[model samples]
Target: MRRYGQAVLMLLVGAAVLRISLFSALYLRYVQSGLRPYLIASGALLVLLGVAAGVRAAREVPDEDETQDPHEHGHTHTTGPRLAWLLALPAAALLLFPPPALGSYSADREDAQRAAQGIGTFPPLPSGDPVDLSVAAFTSRAVYDSDRSLKGRTVRLTGFVTHGDDGTWYITRLLVSCCAADATTSKVEVRGADAPATDTWVTATGIWHPKGRLGSSAAWPPLLDAKAVRRVEEPSNPYEQR
Candidate 1:
């Protein structure tokens, strides 16, 4: 049993990743949904390998006498570096604490110079009052469409709060082309309503602020003059797919 302790630890960690990725939503925080199957497959394989190593270690008989072709008992049966066992600690952290989609914590750390996605001439807003929009779609229209595509239009935007330096806050969401690693901010400076705590999810109904100069490619998304602000639950899939 002692001989296979490290192998058992590996098996537990691999099982953890597989369990969380399959049974929980945190997997969406680290990677895209399309990659879920691959993670499950890979985790399963690692677990099987660990089990095999444990079985092999248990089957090996210790040399009874040091003089009878003996070496250190632990080294003789254990074929892998002990240091490799430490990798399991970080892998297990995910299971210890639930990982939600990137929230205010991640958004605040993001570079202000990151470019907005979906930039270009925007099509006319589909006819309606209080049109629903993704953070990316709203940001592009607000930033690039100079004729005020969003002017006088009522809109609903859902996002977490990114506390800003100027005492205001950004209603923010990350736009991921493939995964969170490649995500960029698509935020709007929200005015009129009190800023919510960082990472707190909320739905805001608002009209666009029509005056700020759209900065360079790396500029922040345009501001929204919010009509209402209220707390809400985080969406099941939080990142905006670009």
Candidate 2:
């Protein structure tokens, strides 16, 4: 712990970063895609620094003139190094078992913070049946669009499932402006379909079930009358960009 503790910690952290950002798409769980280059660079630099430190430590020699007294040697000052090793635990976890993207727990926490967006007119959606749309896009249109853009349209939305307090289920995706810390939930109430397991990714094809006037609270957590629901693999990037 004394000789190479810092080096080992740095290597562990750098390897963790590389595991998530450079070697795979797991970084998407924590940050926006645009930050990948920065993360990769930072991870590479840490690895290089760790390697250099290890080499320097390996070539070091104990100071013969600065011998410790036997009384002090038996009660050494190893506490700091021991505590420092604790920092490596999270890094090791990240490298071995990266965490999943934000899910129902995060979504539920946003219940009180879901602000109502101002109403506006949106551009007409592309002409097609069962048009694919992100959960955030669909939610915005269903709640705020003055023209009721989602009316009469068969849209497909994909997200993990989250249960409500009243036994209802939603297709929910987190919306991130930068990273998971600032992520907001975008969910749609699904009717006419049985819910999959919580946190299970799924694609729902449905038409908007209008509840109230646009720009009103009653219109939110926009309703979807699902015609079909199919289980799907979670996307590499689970969050919708804001």
Candidate 3:
């Protein structure tokens, strides 16, 4: 029973290594921020326990002249020594070069745009405080009906990317409720000299101008006179704050 347990534990470690290597993006999607540290700690503890059990099993052997044959002793041979190093390779890659958040690669994918989904009407902005409407909300309204409620009002939004198909540029942003797996792209297309470079974070202050269409996908409000377009670092939580 002990030998069987040790074999199962080793196989689990091997599987974990492969998951962290080829499917890191998938792993990141499911594991939330604080949960990651706990996973790492638990994994380390299991690995150490397995190692100890393996060492003990290696030291136990039947006497040569026992009543039963030595080969019949309750030990199962394992090829663990040959495969144990594979367990460390994934960790090494992450330590040396961590991957960037899923960005432009997903942006160009047709399924990434949320405008194709239904649009909703946003209430009027309050008199003093800046109104915070999601890129999804803004795009939905404009796509369904250009002359909806989001016109001629000053708005504030944050996102990455600052270019458009019509030679004009924008300060685009994405709203991600969870991880990158479910991220939906939405942008406040701004056209002006102060437009930042691609992928640069910017907080844009401008009025929504419902004029042009985003290819065949949907119509969006354009920024006529952007008051400010200052570049800022990407937020820790890259997804849209729900």
| Model 2 per-residue lDDT at 229 | 99
How much is 150 displaced in model 1, in angstroms? 1.6
Error of 1 at 51 (Å): 2.2
Please give, for residues 1-242, the per-residue lDDT of candidate 3 as tens digits.
33435544554664464354334533353333545555565656666766777777667773354345546777644656546556556555544455666664566453434345454445555664345555655555556543466566666777776465676675555555555666656655675556567777777766667655642353544443566677778766555544
Q: lDDT tens string, model 1, 104-162? A: 77677766563443345667888998999998888777766655678889999999888
Local distance difference test, per candidate?
A: 0.78, 0.89, 0.57
At residue 219, candidate 3 shows an lDDT of 53
- In order of appearance, the predictions have TM-scores of 0.82, 0.94, 0.61
Q: What lDDT is reached at residue 241 by model 1? A: 91
Badly placed stretches (over 4 Å) of model 3 are: 1-84, 111-116, 144-147, 212-218, 221-224
Q: What lDDT score is found at residue 67 in candidate 1?
A: 36
Tell me how far the alpha carbon of residue 200 in candidate 2 is from the true structure, in angstroms, after superposition.
0.7
**Best-performing candidate as measured by lDDT:** 2
Backbone atom clashes (below 3 Å) for every candidate: 0, 0, 2
